[model samples]
Target: MKIFRKLRLQELLYNKKDKRLATAIKLMVGRKPLNLSLFKLAVKHSSAAEETKHGIKVSNERLEYLGDAVLGTIVAEHLFIKFPYRDEGFLTETRSRIVNRESLNQVGKKIGLEKIVESDLTEKGFFTHKSIYGDTLEALVGAVYLDRGYYFCRKFVLSRIISPHFDLDNIINTTINFKSKIIEWSQKENREVDFLLKSITGSQRFKEFTVELKIDQEFFTEGKGPTKKKAEQEAAKNACEKLKLAI
Candidate 1:
C-alpha cells in the first residue's frame, strides 16, 4: 500500500498543473509544500472559485479567514514577547498597524504574491486592487498553517514576513495618534492648533471627511479620510511632515 501510494503521488506531481503550483509555492515559502492542493486553493480568489467533485465550491476565502486568526495570534504573541513592558493598548495598536490592509498589501506586493493570484482584474488593473494582494497574503498564511502546522507557519511568518519586511523599531515608535502628537508639539511651541472640518461628502457607506489644520491662525495643511478622526490624523501627519517634525 505504501509503495502504491508513493507511486500515485509521484504520478500526480508529474502532471503539469501540479508541478507548476508546487514550484510556485516552493519559491514563495522558501520550502517545498507537502500539499499542493491546499496551496492552490490559497492562491485562488473568490472570483475564480470552482465546484469540487462533491459540488462544493472552494476558494481562498476560508483559508483567508483561518489565516486572519492565525496571523493575529502570532502577531499578538510576538508583540507580547517583544514588548514585555508595554501596555495592552500599545500592543493592540501595534498589531493593528502591522496587520492593517495597506501594510498587508504592501507586504504581499513586495513578496510577489500578486503574480499567483487568480483574479479577473481587467477593468481596474491588478495593481490598482490592493485588497487582492492583501487577501492572498492572508490565504498564503493559512496554507502554510495547514501544510506545515503552526510551528513552521509561525517561523515562516517571523523570518520571511516580519523580519525581512517590517522595521520593528519604526513600527513600535510610529506615532499613531498624530493628532495628539501635533497638539503636544503646539503646546511646546506655544502655538494654537485647531482642526476644522471643512467638508463632508459622499453617501453613508462611502463618506469622506476633509479636515484643515490651522497652527497659530495660519493654515498649515489639509487632509481627507473616510472618517473625521482619520481626517484629523492625516491633517496632523501632513502638518508634521511640512514642519519636518520627528514623529
Candidate 2:
C-alpha cells in the first residue's frame, strides 16, 4: 500500500508538471503535444542535465544535433524551390543567413523560449553564452520532428517559425559576405590578410572555434563560431565593420 501510494503521488506531480508544459508548448507551437516528455527534455540545457544511476547525463544536446540536420535540410529545400534561377552559392549563403546562431538566437527569444527553458546559468552567464537559446531552438525542432514527423515539422518550421520571424527579402538583399569583401579590399590595397585559428573549446559535438584576423601582420579582430569557416567569416565581418567597408 505504501509503495502504491508513493507511485500515485509521483504520477500526480508528473501530471501537474506536464499540464503546465503542455500549455506553454501549445501557445508556442500552436498545437498540443502528444508526448510531453520530449518537450520537457527539449527545454533542458546541458548545464542542468540529470545524471542517471548508470553514470550517463541526459540533456538536449542529442536532440540539438538531430534538429540541426533537419533544420538545414528543410531550409535548403525551401531555398532551392524558392530560388529556382539562383545558383548553388546563393542558396547556400541564404540558408546560412537564416539558420545561423545569431539569427536563431533572436528567433528563439522572440518565440518566448526564455521563459520555458530550464537552465542553471545566471542572468549574466546566460547572456554570455549567446548560443544557448539557439541550441535550445534546435533541440525544440528535434522534439517537434520526433513528436510530429517530417511533414508536420516542416510545416511548423516554415509557417510558424520561419515565415513569422524572418524577413527573406532583407536577408537576400543584405551583403553579409564580409570575408569576400575584406579579401577584395586587401588585394586592392596590396595588403596581406590572414585568418589564424586561435583555439577550440567544448566537446566534439559542440566545439567552438576562435579565429583571429590579421591584416599587414597586425591583429585586426577576432571571432568565434561553431565551425572554422564561420569563425573566419565572423573575424572578417568584424574587421570590415572596423574598417567601415561593410555596406
Off by over 4 Å in 1: 1-12, 52-56, 125-129, 177-247
In TM-score terms, candidate 2 sits at 0.71
| lDDT by residue for model 2 (1-247), tens | 4574445443355567687888889898777776677999999998899999999999999999999999999999999999999999899879988997878988999898998899898888776666888999999999999988999999999998899999999999887788999999999999999999999999989999999999988998999999999999989988876775624
What number of clashing residue pairs does each candidate have, in the order they appear?
0, 0
Segments in model 2 whose C-alpha atoms lie over 4 Å from true places = 1-14, 177-212, 215-247
In model 2, state the lDDT of residue 175.
74
Q: For model 1, what is the error of residue 170's alpha carbon versus the real structure, in angstroms, after optimal superposition? A: 0.7
Winning candidate number (TM-score) = 2
Error of 2 at 228 (Å): 20
- How close is every model to the real structure, measured as TM-score? 0.68, 0.71
What is residue 238's positional error in candidate 2, in angstroms? 9.1
Residue 176 error for model 2, in Å? 2.4
The candidate 1 region of ten consecutive residues with least summed lDDT is 4-13
Clashing pairs for model 1 are none
